[model samples]
Target: MNAYGINPDPSEITEITPAVDGVESIPLPLYGYNVSAGFPSPADDFIEEYLDLNQLLVKHREATFFVRVSGCSMTGAGIYSGDILIVDRSLDPAHGKIVIAVVSGELTVKRLVMRNGRAILRSENPNYPDIPAGDELRVWGVVTSVIHKV
Candidate 1:
C-alpha cells in the first residue's frame, strides 16, 4: 500500500512540468523573530531580510523537482492532498524515507521499508495495505520536504 493506504490508479497521477517562462525566482522577507504559536511576543516586529526559498529548499537544482500530492494516503506522514512535495533524485532512497516511485508504470509516493529482505511500500495511513516492491518497481526520488499552505 502506498502512503494513502491504497493503490493509486495510473490515471490519478499527474506530472508537473517546470515553469519555463521568464519567471526566475521568488524571494520573500524572512522575519528575525521567531513567531510563537502560543502567546504573543514583542519580537514579531523584526525583519531579517529577503530570503530566497530556492536556496533553502533546493540543495541540488538539477535533481530537484516539485510534485503536487493528489491523495490522502500520506496524511499520516503529514503529507496531505494539495501539498507540494520537494523530491530529490540525487538522494539515496534509504529505508524509512519517503520516496516517489513507479510501480508497473504507475507513479506513487510512499515510505520505503524493508521486510524479510524484500522492499515494501508502506502507506502512512492505517486504512491502506502494504505493497510489495516487485520487479517492476523503480525508485524515482526521495522526498525531502512537503509544502502546505494554511
Candidate 2:
C-alpha cells in the first residue's frame, strides 16, 4: 500500500521468517508499577522482577514465527511497513484477529473476519478491498505481537 493507505500493489510482498530457537535469554529489569501517561507520578526505584521478552510474548515456542510487513495495508491497525509481526500457528483464526495468511501463494498480513460461514481477509485500511477466502486461502498463523522501533 502507498502512503495514502490505499491502492495495494500486487508486486509488494510480505516476508516470513521462522523464529530461531536456542538463543540465550537476556533478562531485563522490570518495574512493578505501571507508569502514568497523563500525569506526573512518583516512580518506583526498585526492580520488581526480571523480564524476558520471548517468555512474555511467545505462548507457543515451536509454533511461532516472524513476518516482516512490506506495506501499509494494515496501517489503521498501527502496523506499518518494516514492522516485525510475531505470528503463532497454534492460535485459532478467530474473528477479528490479524493473521498471516497465504492467498494465491502469496503471504499477506490482514485481519480475519468470519461472516455467515464465510471468511474474508480484511485490510485495516478502508481504501483496500476485502479478500474473500477461497480454495487458495490458507491461514498460516494468528499475529500475536508487533515489534516496532520507536
Candidate 3:
C-alpha cells in the first residue's frame, strides 16, 4: 500500500547519477516534472550555482545501493511507500536497527528485535504482524537513509 496514496509504476525507480568523481551511479527518482507544461527556467547563474557539486555536504561517493519502498508497513517510521532507501551493506546490522532482510526467499524491511533466544522482525505499523525467525532469514543490510519526494 502507498502511504502517500500515490501508486507510481515500478519502472519509475530508475537511478540518477550524482555529478561527483568516483561515485558509483545509484538510482534516484526523476525530480523534474511539468517542464513541458511551460515551467519557467531559473536564471542561468542560479541553476549553475545550485548544480555545482562542490557546494554539497554529502558526496555521492558515500552511497552504496539504493532500494525503493513499496508498502505502508514502515510508514510510522517515516519510511513511506515510494521512498528510496540508501543501504550500506558494509555496515553491520545490530539490534534495534532498521534493516532489510530476506526470509524464505522474500525481501522485507523491519526493525530487528532480539529477545531471549529468538529474533522478531517488528514492523513500524502495528497493523502488520511481527515476523518470527521460523523461516530461513538472512540480514541483507542496514538502512542508512530514506530519501523521499517532497
Most TM-score-accurate candidate? 2
TM-score of 3: 0.61
Q: Report lDDT (CA) for all predictions.
A: 0.77, 0.80, 0.64
Candidate 2 residue spans exceeding 4 A from truth: 1-13, 37-44
| The 10-residue segment with the lowest total lDDT in model 3 | 3-12
**2 or 3: which has the higher lDDT?**
2
Q: Give the clash count for each candidate.
A: 8, 0, 3
Off by over 4 Å in 1: 1-12, 19-23, 38-45
Q: Please, what are the lDDT tens digits per residue for candidate 2 over residues 15-112?
A: 76777789788898787676766533435565688899989888888899887888778889998888889999999899999988787667888899
Q: Give the Cα error of residue 35 in candidate 2, in Å.
A: 2.9
lDDT of 1 at 106: 73
Question: Evaluated with lDDT, which candidate comes out highest?
Answer: 2
lDDT of 1 by residue, 11-30 (tens): 22365544233546888867
lDDT of 2: 0.80
**Residue-level lDDT tens digits of model 3 in 58-133:** 3334544677878778878898878877766667888899887776655678888898977777788877767776
